[model samples]
Target: MTTTVRVLESSEEDVRRGPEIIIHENKYEFCRYNLKISRFINANLGFSAHVWDAGVALCRYFEKEKINFTGKKVIELGSGTGIVGILAALLGGYVTMTDKPKVLKQIETNVSINIPSVCRHRVNIRPLMWGENHTNFNPAYDFILGSDIVYSSVVYPALIETLRYLADQGATIYLSSELRKSNGSPDFHNNLLPHYFNCQVVDRIEGKDVVVYKMTKIATTSEEDPLPSKE
Candidate 1:
């Protein structure tokens, strides 16, 4: 039998330097699972820990098909709460987990606690701000990940630009979002025509909403055979 610790409803688990935690006891053991995470990677998903759990569930949608993420260059943008992206790292993606400069350390802390095994060597930390022109973008990510990043109409232009810039020639962009009443999807679709990003609704699960997108460097009208990056 293993020991278990009851999680405090609210604790002074600092959110800045170390991973803020909510220890929960299960049948066998107690674990200091981190919570209250906000921002990992670059895209801005307005975050609430409870709400972000929905996004984490969505990230695992691809696993149902048994597609291995091992040894893939993956980036989780707008990693608000960092849970999804950290999970990706644990699964074996050479994950570059970035976010805003202010919250980069926080993102680092969360990953370290949940997946200390891979954070330093595999999961890299960096700063990626949306709407800003970034020349130091990685061109080798097999998949770009985001969770619930669609927030407001004001941020649509920046978000779209950021997504386009980081995406490689043939990269799969997996996003998890709930179609909320006041989400930014409307504004995003409005600008997608003039720009080019082959977006598609691949999966929509009950508890989690999954949208798979394909992006390319050049513009093409050929919609039938958009070169898929990976499954």
Candidate 2:
């Protein structure tokens, strides 16, 4: 017996549009946001942004889990198009959406238009280069979000270091990635073992080759001894 696989063709509407509105819904409400897409063929990758499947999976996972962001401090790494961070802010988180400096403007525009005036103050757009010194960023974030950031092996060390630097001891981390091999190995997931504990796959998209990971920082030992000798 032989098996056949079907591949669906993309429509012209899907190919031609520059910016499009993406609608995501949960049990309670719906989130409607516009995404700015890059039109120039020679434009930088950051400039030509579009929603990724992993990003959509993340949004759905958050909705299903009903993760409470109310009054919590959150940061998103490699926040292209800023969709995940925007969703967190909508759920009442004080969110910082960060990416390369070149992409900040696009994130800013999305935040300005999609985030309501009341929740506007809770959202900030900034530039973040992984593995670099980020002394200006607060070290106590309650939650960190990332989507499709693990596709490149070159960024693994820097990304892991940045995560360790930003996350508080009890901080929750949510990362989504498409299940695809990169540079011949899955270094992005494999490299995270040392710095994080209780790492688990919290969610998976049924038909999409995407998974979301929920992890917490490993407990660090104190540099100084607890017991002190009397003089």
Residues 1-231, model 2: lDDT tens digits: 111112122122233334543222121122333333322222364422655667767877776767779999999998877778888888889998998887776677667767778779898888888877555798788999998877666666677667777875578999988777744224456554433555777887776667788988776643421211111
Candidate 1: where is the Cα deviation over 4 Å? 1-54, 187-195, 207-231
On residues 58-118, what C-alpha lDDT tens digit does candidate 1 reach at each position?
4445444445568898887876456667767767778887677766655775666667663
Q: Which ten residues in a row have the lowest lDDT in candidate 2?
A: 1-10
Judged by TM-score, which candidate is best?
A: 2
TM-score of 1: 0.67
* Residue 136 miss distance in model 2 (angstroms): 2.3
What's model 2's lDDT at 89? 88
TM-score of every candidate: 0.67, 0.76
**lDDT value for model 1:** 0.56
True-vs-predicted CA distance for residue 118, candidate 2, Å: 2.2
Provide the lDDT at 112 for model 2: 74
lDDT for every model?
Answer: 0.56, 0.68
